[model samples]
Target: MSNLVEFNETSAPGFVLLGFTERAELRLLCFFVFFTIYAVTLAGNLGVVVLIRLDLGLHTPMYFFLSHLSLLDICYSSTIIPQALWSLVVAKPGISFPGCVTQLFSFATCATTECYILAAMAYDRFVAICNPLLYSVLMSQRLCVGLVAGAYLAGVISSTIHTVAIFHLPFCRSKKIDHFFCDGPPLLALSCSDTHLSELVVSALVGFNVLSTTAFIVTSYSRVLAAVFRMRSPPASRKTFSTCASHLVSITLYYGSSLFMYLRPSSRHSLEDDKVVSMLYSVAIPMLNPLIYSLRNADMKRAMRKARGRVLSLATRGSQAPERRGGPLHG
Candidate 1:
């Protein structure tokens, strides 16, 4: 038993993230680009939240889920963009063990939440389109609240399991993580311990989350298509399809990139290539979410205009109040 130890215990305590490796001159360029994305992500998502709150017309189940999606985008971008921007600007892009784990946990949580939220949105569309008469009854305020709560709970549980499985692995060799963020695949590659359990768990979660949600979405859309087709009137069918097109596009882009990254076997792990793919879902998707929703959604555009006007009016009133108070010719 005493002679069973195979390797020494000393190991690197942290990791150096290689980030983007195209060119050194691209560092500033990348930083500015990502900074713009982060700003837009925050403003767009927060704008949606504010619009949903201020506009009575948007106080429905659809907008409620939209608001939560916006919030998830904000949280998701916040988890990765800041650190990524810092890594690009700073000389070193190092992360401690605990920091890496925390980042991984938050990222996984937001991502899982987005998956479930998309499914909920799909279901909402089903009810709204397939059974308009009972839409409100099926998707009451209580039900909406329950669905949002369930999404968050599912996210937390999935993240907890993944993070725990990851941290339990022993790290005894190279600690360099070759990605902009702490993702499951990259972290798994760095583990010296036998990662069969972790790999299996990650694969199972990915399969269950993506495949299950995809099935639900497909079923909902199938029923939706059938309903629209049976209407027989071209205009009505077109309108129904238009209503779901934006959501379908979003779902395709999101799950497409995510599935490409996670669902593949571990033998296909290429840190350099995987990093590029991860950016699509992590950075690009968040930036595109608001554009997709706002451009396609008339209610959101109107609400945004009203909210902007309100802000401008308040600013003008604030400026005039100071001037009126300071006037000296009052009798």
Candidate 2:
């Protein structure tokens, strides 16, 4: 009993996050690269949210869900990137046990919420394409609100489960986490207790989330394609395809990387490999989402132009007002 008490007392209460690499030059390069990505991600995702909100033309089921998605991306990226950037430059990048748990919960919530949001977006497209006449009626405002709420609720529940289950276990082993962020597998590796059930719980939840969302999206898109092919008007079909194309790209980037990261067997889990893959789904995807949606979708392009025009007009008017006031004649 005394030896056990000594062992527990000697273990650190905080965790050391050994970031991507330890070399000084590489750390500098990583810091700059990730800082730039974080800036772009914040600007792009926030722009999407603001644009959707301000532009009345974008007030539809598609953009409604898209706005929520942008918020999620912002949150998702924020949860990981700042800490990672800090960890890169610091001599000792450590996080308290509470902080680690908080990060895990935050990161998990954003990720899971994003999964359902993407699925919801797919369903919105399904209704619009597959049930054109009844699109608005089916995807009513109340229903959309409920869907978003449900996604968040589901995320919170899943995160709580994972956080409680993992942190409750004793982590008496080495305090050095092998990855950048406080992710599940690395944290599990630090535990002195058996983590079989925790592993099972994580795998089950992740599998269910990933597979279910992917299935819904695939099924939705399949029906959409069939409906498009059946359309007699080539232009209409093209337009339908164009609208769905941006969504397809976003879905591919997020789900493809996430599936690669989470759904793999534990035996093949490599910390080094996991960092690169996690960077994709967590960091890169958020930066790409706004660009994907805006650059490809005609509506977003038009909205950008209109918003630009408004800003330019406001600036011009403001300048003219100052000049008019300074001039002698037009009082």
Candidate 3:
């Protein structure tokens, strides 16, 4: 117990995050691209959340899960992007050991929560499409709330296990992490202590969590597809499929990238390859999720248009009022 505490606490050394400094010319481009991505990700996720709140028609089980998903995306991206941008500006970009642990906890919690949230969403779609008669009964407001709470609980539990396990292993080799963030596979590579146990634990945890949710999604969609084909209405089938298309796209991008990064043996982890893949799941997908999920949503589009109109109208009225006050301009 004393040894483990020492490993996790002040004994931890300051670690340098050796990001993309080799290509000076490309760093500028990378910075702009990532900055743009970060900005868009924030806007997109927040926009969806706000839209869901304001639009009454969007207060359904599907959008309920979607709002929470947007929240997770915001947190997940925030955990890494700001630090990454800051690293580009400084000569020595190193995070304190505590800061690294905090980053890992925050990102892991959000990411793990997302996994189950996606599964819950799949189950919701399954009930709605496959068993529409009992959809309302099975996916009640109380049940939706419980499922969301469970997803968050699962995230907390998973992150706690991973954080405790990984940090207990002393990282005493080179105090330099080659990737941009404090991810599990890369952090495991830095441990001076025997990492076979840590590696085994991490792989088992990550693999089970990812695979179970993925299997759930696949199984639910398979049933949904079968049900879709059985219906005689073409328009109904199209509409039903449209509801899940965004989620499918998001799953493909995020799951595909994450599986490539973490599911493999840690021995096969290439810093260069892992870094690029990290950017995809951590940065790019968050930005793309809002677009994929909400762009085709007619209700959200209508709500956004109304919000934009309201802003323009308010600005126009304010501008005219100042000019209309002829004498002293209402000063």
The parts of candidate 3 lying over 4 Å away from their true place are: 1-12, 312-331
Give a tens-digit lDDT track for model 2, residues 71-153: 99999888899889978867557777889989999999999999999999999999998888999899999999999999999
State the TM-score for model 3.
Answer: 0.90
lDDT of 1 by residue, 280-330 (tens): 999989989988998877677788888889999999999899778878757
- Residue ranges of candidate 1 with Cα displaced over 4 Å: 1-12, 308-331
Using TM-score as the measure, name the better of candidate 1 and candidate 2. 2
TM-score of each: 0.89, 0.94, 0.90
Q: Estimate, for each residue in 1-331, the C-alpha lDDT of model 3 and write its tens digit.
A: 1111122323446777777774656666767877999999999999999989987888989999999999999998899999887666554467898999999999889888999999999999999999999999999999999999999998999888888889998877777788888888788888888988877887777888899999999999999989999989999888888877888889999899989988887668898999899998988888999999877666667778888898899999998986888658556
Clashing pairs in 2: none
- Backbone clash count for every predicted candidate, in the order shown: 0, 0, 0
Ranking by TM-score: 2, 3, 1
Residue 168 accuracy (lDDT) in model 3: 95
What residue runs in model 2 are displaced by over 4 Å at the alpha carbon?
1-12, 329-331
In model 1, where is the ten-residue run with the lowest total lDDT? 1-10
For each candidate in the order shown, give its overall lDDT on alpha carbons.
0.86, 0.89, 0.85
